[model samples]
Target: MVPITRTVPAPSSVRTARAPRRVTRPAIPGVVLAVIGLGAMAVVSLWWRDTPVIHGFGAMLTGAGQVLGLLSGYGFVVLVALMARLPPLERGIGADRLARWHAMGGRYVISLVTGHVLAITWGYAVTAHESVTSEAVTLLTSYPDVLMATVAWFLLLGIAAFSARAARRRLAYETWYYAHLYTYLAIALAFSHQFADGASFAGNLAARVAWSSLYALIGGLIAWYRLVTPLLMFARHRFTVAGVRPEAPGIVSVYITGRDLDALGAEPGQFFRWRFLARSLAWQSHPYSLSAMPRPDMMRITVKARGDHSGSLSSLRPGTRVIAEGPYGAFTPALSGRRVLLVAGGVGITPIRAMFAALPRRMSEGITLIYRASNPRDIVFRQELDAIAADRGAVVHYVVGSRARLGYDPLSALYLRAMVPGLHRYEAYVCGPAGMTRAVVAALRASGLRRRRIHHETFDF
Candidate 1:
């Protein structure tokens, strides 16, 4: 494709001035942390109230187990809340950050559950003058809800094992995702056991009421954001595929036409978790960034053939029904500086391309885009980017070559400083493969940009 380099006047919308939206980064995270801390305190208070005396080793072990179990139950609630896809948390803390927190928290919670089981079993064994194995068997067979809790524990362990980094590599995305859905079932099975057997909850009406309320709140959030909102969007907008246009060898842009799209409140750099109502495609939803600015009746998303779901999008028929979960993410130009820099790698250019067109150019020093691709053929949206650059009086640099061919990294700190004079004054946005994103972020920091000035989101879960 021939590159369009001739300068043309920018559209009136592009030329118009709009003040950037200010977001206080620490405010939401601080509130979330404070709430979690409050929950922890409440869990400990239950144990304090119930445990008035502990005179023996067995009693001490059992008391510790009780506290651990209560905290673990509370942790599960927090874990679900993090992944509930609430708009405030998603936009404030970011989806990638929330996923990282959930993964880390899962590990800790699993460890707590294991500790709770061991301590409780050992304590019971000592108190009854019985073998540990005998005590465990009795607990499972005779206790009111111990059997179900044991099953839940095993299910949780299985999920954690599959979620490990090594196991994730061997598993398909769909397989791993579906396996995680069982977590809700496990939590449900464990709930009755917590109430029936937990020392902290036994005869403690206030504790039981508070614990139940926490679970109810998280469940409501998930139902509204993850379920009801999408159904509402489908009913209101009625999104459907309009066409599929191949961009490069393996990338295609899917056009979606919808009614009252502007009411969806989709911004330039946000993405949607789209579930296409087609054979083999309706079961899974994948997040795709908007590849262009949304029109009143249409939007576009560019997909690269990475796996089964993405590979099938190019063959999607026109008029295919779609259910989109969001216009989510906080990667927009809202918090950017007057002098802005966008760096995109391979298929990561989708959101960057949209931001390039929509970012107001008036009262700005300059806007620069650095697109990195393995080869010329790997570059997507070349012609459109060149046209936008020409029209907006922005700079577009296509850094196309393999690392071996180039002999050195073009996005290194020294090179970045040379390419964009006064780089310290610019706010940078980066999206790419994990390695490339990390490298570019390091380069930006080394080039004197502060951490807050560099914004990024990775698709790596």
Candidate 2:
């Protein structure tokens, strides 16, 4: 790889020319969906007025229970819908944003369900003039679906406990992911009781049909996107491993070949959740970004051994079948400005490498890549990156060294502006570990780039 050594002469200190601000609408639809969910729960509460109420503590408790139950049911549907992998919502709202919403919403739904259980049990005890324990036993025995729902409640509670940050840190991604499959069963068992035993739902035919429809629609979406779509693509493409070659220590590139590869509609700078159907790896899947421009019948992904699953990607046998889940993500060339700067850290260089291959070029050089690694020996794809830079005259800067405290960092505001002639006009794409990403983003902002001009591909689960 050719090292960057030439420096643009700095006659004076940096002069900042800010890019004009551009407003974004990525979150508008997501916000509207959230508002509608809250409002729908509010409307569900109105159904309670149609029933007779005792004018005492029992009545208040009963009403609270009904409202909480309503909120949880609504939340369950929305939570599943958000993760159903609906292309429009995922592309518009962003996969990272949707994942955050799903996780946060899960916490609230669990709380609401807990409140519903306690309030309803206490309210029923008061209404029946019985001890809380006996009333709970009676209700559980009397309701047709309550027993299943109780078990479902525990399952949801367990999932919530497993999802805690501390718990997640101890588990492998495969374990954490398989544990999430129980969520579908929990949702089914928990929702069954709403129509069968719900006081507010007893006489409301319209509400029953509406609730049923919501669940059915969400179920259909999940079935299509999560199961059916990928199976169809796998059958059609028949992707198989072609070769595996080492790029650097602990890093390897996997090449895959398939039929009519163009039909996948894969754009550069996108990724797939890949499942290699070989011994011990038949069911587990992990996301990896395309590391090279897509060829009509083949594609390539570079993987660094980061975990048990990732470490196994190097020894895949030739002809092992592959199942892929996407061309999903908005990190393509369409998001670039007239001038573009790409910042990559460690294995984060995967998508940026593909983008560099495909991003539109200006007559004058328009692409700048700043790759950060611990040292020169750790820089993956050095030869290919150099080839692209030399062929296209794109600027390449390798920031390599141990993490050291310094006021004069190469990625600091002044240095970034000095490297790129029109830094303010450049759209910056950053991908790195969380800490490094934050630092680079701050430097880009200080270099006079607007918020809308900075794009980062977020792969955090």
Judging by lDDT against the true structure, name the best candidate: 1
Off by over 4 Å in 2: 1-54, 129-131, 363-365, 405-415
Model 2 scores what on Cα lDDT? 0.78
Lowest-scoring 10 consecutive residues by lDDT in candidate 1?
Answer: 3-12
Predicted candidate 1 versus true structure: per-residue lDDT over 1-461, tens digit per residue: 42212221222134331223454456677898898999899789878988879978888888888889988999999999999999988877778888999999999999999999999999988888899999999999999999999999999999999999999999999999999999999999999999999877889898789889989999999999999999999999999988787778888888888898767776667889999999999999999998865566777899999999999998898889999998888777755367889999999998888888776656146789999999898898877788778777888889999989999999899989988899899989898999999999999999899998998877778
Q: Please write out the lDDT profile of model 2 over residues 190-215, one tens digit for every residue.
A: 88798887877788888788888988
For each candidate in turn, the TM-score is 0.94, 0.88
Q: Model 2, residue 122: displacement in angstroms?
A: 2.8
